[model samples]
Target chain A: MSYPRLLRRTLLYIGATAFALWVLIPIFLIAISSFTPPNEIYAWPKPIIPSRFSLDTMRFFLNSYGVLNSLRNSILVALLTLAFTLAVGAPAGYAVARFSFRGREAFRLGILITRMFPTALLAVPLAVTFIKWGLYDTLIGVALIHTAMALPFAVIITTGIFMGVPKDLEEAAMTLGCSRFGAFVRVALPLALPGLAAAAMFTFVISWNEVFAATILTVNNRTLPAHILTTIQASPLYFRFAGGFFMTIPALFFMFFIRRYLFHMWGGATAER
Target chain B: MAAEIRLEKVRKTFGKVVAVKDMDLLVEPGEFLVLLGPSGCGKTTTLRCIAGLERVDHGRVYIGGRDVTELPPSKRGIAMVFQSYAVFPHMTVAQNIGFGLRMRRAPKNEIKKAVQEVARLLQIDELLDRYPSQLSGGQRQRVAVARALVMRPEVLLMDEPLSNLDALLRLQMRAELKKLHREVGTTTVYVTHDQIEALSLGDRIAVMREGEIMQLDAPNEVYDMPANVFVGGFIGTPPMNFLRAEVRKEDGGVYLAVGDFSVEVHKEWQEKLEGMVGKKVVLGIRAENIEVRPTPEGGALPARVVVSEPLGAQQLLTVQVGKDVLKVATSTELSATPGQTIGLVLTKAKIRLFDEESGEALKFD
Candidate 1:
């Protein structure tokens, strides 16, 4: 209605729009640059566009230094981590939510405490232990460590999901025909499937994206994140940008797969606790 | 329309707190047995014990003459409709009702037929394709009943199943539950804290208090001749009014001394209460049985109506008598405003007396 109000409103809109662009621009540039010809990629302040697009840099990242093997290792490691976390975490979540066993409250507190310890603190000791166990470069070793890393989060997410399911329904199942375990499998678990799916996806992504632990834990058998670190940096800024793009694709794809349950299980919960 | 069920000294304890304490009950074949009590008073625990959902700490359970305390619910041949319906959200109504049938590995054709028949019986045939979330509260309630009945188990246990429904729906469902039980002929154990439900639906009601059954009999008998103060007070609408009183023998005549007045014990009651003479007791009378009229020839306690709750057919009158407030329900269609002086009479036949210390009925031994 007034000029100052109009100007203020216009300034606010521009500020908000600029903020959004600032966040998304680097991601967009990495995607475009990852496909650019390496000869022109490092030119000047930066090429506004890749006049000729090629997959050479992406192809190079895939083959050289066994980056493709790293990708496979990361997927395999993440999958194993997801499976183990869900297997161990789901039951733990159910027990913490539904039962009143001794030290149950302490068990929940213990899960939280495990997450509080810095990953760096465990890296050296874990590496030393892995070597002794003949698992230093093995995917299973990486997966087990990743499970411990992802377990607290998996347990917390699924605990919330199990709590949301009314206890009356499970008890009702018990009365009808189900044993206590049967009720969980036939009733509670199925209802919590979406939340469990999201938890598994998240644990996978966390395992996939982890580099410090991966670097410390392995030498030749490395994950994508650990392998990328050796070649992603170049004398040129463009290679760094290209590597960023390569690391982000799997995460973006995985995020999309569980995007529905992200807002559902994680967004509301993970932010607070 | 119900199966026979028996509990022999069933006792359940949760840590230090006893939930159902050494309860023994019997339900006749084709009869509806309702366990009624306040929250935490063990009605639900009793029902769950019968369903084998909860294990008894020290007793045996029997359904249709076979010992079932050691058997699981399915093996005991019982089905339960939960307060929350317990219908699987992922399945259609048909699948939910047919689940037990499938568990029995019934022939596919028979399972389909049973589900269809129960669906039609409960008028949920059209809802068979829909999920539980798609149905209304009342529709889901019917679906739960259909689910339990389709199994045709020997017994059916329901725990406060109608409590989640709206008032109008509750009344409608109560009537429908009676009709359904009549048709299905499964022995049913229904539990509720609502006195009205206990009265209306239970063929025989067991009034429980503090983990023990106070009284168990035909619903009308439990209502009319309650065993003790708690049963008398707990099994009626607005609850029966209880006041401290003393029974005394005066001038070769037996009398009960109540608040602000004394009434001559009717000859029949005089003999039954002879032992309570000169003893302090609780005077119990239902709200409706406490008549407020113009001093009826006998000396009646004069009181002022403190508040009047007027329903169209009947009204509840809260009156002050000797520093104690009493609720009196009237069917005379009389209107009395607050502070209006009224004569209240406690008719002898309708009066109940209990020992003050033990709270046990003081009747002829």
Candidate 2:
């Protein structure tokens, strides 16, 4: 290669390596510290590699008061958020992408504008309503708020997903003895599956990571992130590292399982052959 | 079985823009009717209304003697092939062709047999296991056709089906489609903007313009006796040449007085010309109907050639007659250079006259 082209490629590699290290090093440090014995975790200078591995810190973090309950609450709330968001947002997205009616653009803008309001401002009123409805301090109340928070992103992403599927295929199905709904289910749905999976992943991640809404809505049923934020400062350094490491694993596993579908969100799936 | 389709005073509009005006049409059973027009001329809209894809604001549509105006596309007993050849990209060729049967809950064996038969007919049998993305454009188009034909629909609707193909493949597929229609004998309504395809593939051509049908006739009748000036101009390659003329009476004989010269009107049209004396009319003549002669003859109009284009089989000469330019197609043997003076002989029997104001053909009986 010519000198300039070689120099440009080398610079690109350097930038990519720096970015990779920047994201991976903190996770690496927490993982190592999480497994290190309690005494070594408090060493004068932190070791790059642990002297020995032990599950004692992880065991203690798991056995702590409210930790296991909060872990279960987080999974339930994230699942509930995903189910509610898709059930409501998918049809709304389909309508937004496929139909042209008065106020269509306004409806989309209105959904997006819901996110512009500060969450803190709505907390007192939402908590008051939840208490009246007997939903405060319940997992369901926290999940409801997370669903509301993730809905705009779900609708927007699924709209783009549905738009990538050609209207012609659906119309063709309708002519071939399928009703309008049937056409959507058989033809448009299959074509949009990958992108929808990507949307579901985003919804899950958003709900899992959201702390403010979860913390404000639930007192006894705090999700993992809300529970961690409330208790991490009081804990020892080893417990803090173990809690961080535990929280990051589920999200990492979720992403790894669905990594192939993530590219579909970036226009890898199109109608053309 | 083939079934007739009838539209009664159908009209459709989209937000104050009329896509199809009040139109009436009848397609005989087993007849292949082509709706031919320019873009935005409502031909496709008319076809969609018949297919039950678009609802007419006023009027009724009947298919096989039943009122189907309120029915959805599936319940109307019609199958359509879209311009994009919308084969299901996620399905294999066999699955695509068998989708209708599957939707109707056909038995697995029956569905497989029907798909196989249609695939063999379309000559895509070997490719039935392949996905749409693995096939060529032409093959995917065949898969689409097979899917529609497998339904044995009462009426088949096609919206510019072959327009996406290359020119050579389009010609090939056009012939294949005609043959398939003949074999199946299904009533079909096809829409296209190409005059050649309309003339070749249609049993009857409905020429449309500006949301209305200008003429509906056999291909030969449409080409030979166009009902209006628009049909005449829109149907041919080097569209018909028109010149402004006025009817004049001299020596007890009627004549058409073009810019600086006059031609005697045919005897059968003399009386009609008498009533139109001093009235402006349009004189339309096809390029192939005008003959170029080397020397001036008794009834030939003298003209000067402006440009000559050799199209292999024949030569097209642009000749100036008085102040108007006319296209004349002649045998390739006749070589005429630019600025060369030539005599033009218009075939009197084939000449057409139109009202200058309305652009409607003036008939002489």
Worst 10 residues of 1 chain A by lDDT: A264-273
- Tens digits of per-residue lDDT, candidate 1, B1-365, equal 34588889999999999999998888988888888998999988888888877878999998888898988766778888888877788789998888877777889999999999889999999989999889999999998888888878788889889999999999999999999888777788898999899899988999988999899899888887888878888887788788788888878778888764786667887766676678888888888777788443457778778999887779888988777789998875676888888888887788777889988887654
- DockQ values, each candidate: 0.56, 0.80
lDDT of 1 at B241: 87
Residue A263 in candidate 2, Cα distance off native in Å: 8.1
Chain A alone, TM-score for each of the models?
0.84, 0.87
Q: Distance from true position, residue B127, model 1, in Å?
A: 1.2
lDDT for model 1 comes to 0.83
User: Which parts of model 1 have CA positions greater than 4 angstroms off?
Assistant: A1-23, A47-56, A63-65, A179-181, A233-237, A256-273, B1-3, B272-275, B295-298, B331-333
Candidate 1's displacement at residue B199, Å, is: 0.6
In candidate 1, which residue pairs get closer than 3 Å at backbone N, Cα or C atoms, i.e. clash?
A: B2-B30, B2-B186, B2-B187, B3-B186, B3-B187
**Which lDDT value does model 1 have at A263?**
59
TM-score (0 to 1) of chain B for each candidate: 0.94, 0.97
lDDT of 1 by residue, A93-142 (tens): 77767778889777777887988889898878888898999999999999
* lDDT (10s digit) by residue, model 2, range B1-365: 99999999999999998988899999999999999999999998998899887889999999999999999999999999999999999999999999999998999999999999999999999999999999999999999999999999999999999999999999999999999999999999999999999999999999999889999999988987888889999998888888888999988999998876787667899997788889999898999988889865676888899999999999999989888899999999997989988888888888899999999999887
List the pairs of residues colliding in candidate 2: none
